[model samples]
Target: MAHQESSVLQLKQELLRANMDKDELQSQNVDLQRKMEERSQLAAEYKKELTQKEWLIQQLQGKLDESHRKLSEANYQK
Candidate 1:
């Protein structure tokens, strides 16, 4: 009877530890998921900013090309 009681005590302790470990893992998983969501939003904002910058660059390039064409024509007339 004493041996059976000892075995039951050990099993109870093990179960407690398992519950604590499961709680800790769940907390960590929630934190990681939140961080992933934040990073995903940041990535999307960066992509939008990059797209706007690319459009501006294309507009500037077009203006530059027009200026060069005008300069070439003026030189040829001279």
Candidate 2:
């Protein structure tokens, strides 16, 4: 029947549209995943730099403390 043919045509169009939408969504998901990986790498680099700076600050503080103690001892002896 003509009505049955029309119904079949509509279903095929709907299926084609759904397939296109699914392909677009998959492409977007892949792009988002790549961006997330880049951000994660950047975050890790920043964390490493921060750790190095903290260690340097600790070393400087230790030297400053030693200098202050030596100065105090000399002054007390005088």
Candidate 3:
């Protein structure tokens, strides 16, 4: 009967430790989730900026092509 009581106590202690570990892991998960959300927002902003830059580059390329065409036509007339 004494041995059975000691075993029960040991089981209770193990259960308490497991509960503490679970709480710590849950806290860490929350922190990591918040960081992930922030990183996702930053990435979206960067993608928008990159898209704008690409559009501007395309517009400049169009203007350059137009200038080259006009120059070529003028030289041909000469």
Q: Model 3: runs farther than 4 Å from truth?
A: none
Candidate 2, residue 21: lDDT:
100
Q: Give the per-residue lDDT of model 1 (tens digit) for 1-78.
A: 999999999999999999999999999999999999999999999999999999999999999999999999999999
Instruction: Name the weakest run of 10 consecutive residues (lDDT summed) in model 3.
Output: 15-24
Rank all candidate structures by their TM-score, best first, as comma-separated numbers.
Answer: 1, 2, 3
Candidates 1 and 2, the one with greater TM-score: 1
Q: Give me the overall lDDT of model 2.
A: 1.00
Per-residue accuracy of model 2 over 2-70 as CA lDDT, tens digit each:
999999999999999999999999999999999999999999999999999999999999999999999
CA lDDT scores, all candidates in order: 1.00, 1.00, 1.00
Off by over 4 Å in 1: none
Total clashes, candidate 2? 0
Q: For model 1, how many clashes?
A: 0
| Candidate 2 residue spans exceeding 4 A from truth | none
Backbone clashes for every candidate come to 0, 0, 0
TM of each candidate vs. truth? 0.94, 0.90, 0.85
Model 3 Cα RMSD, Å?
1.4
lDDT of 1 at 16: 100
Relative to the unseen true structure, what is the C-alpha lDDT of residue 58 in candidate 2, on a scale of 0 to 100?
Answer: 100
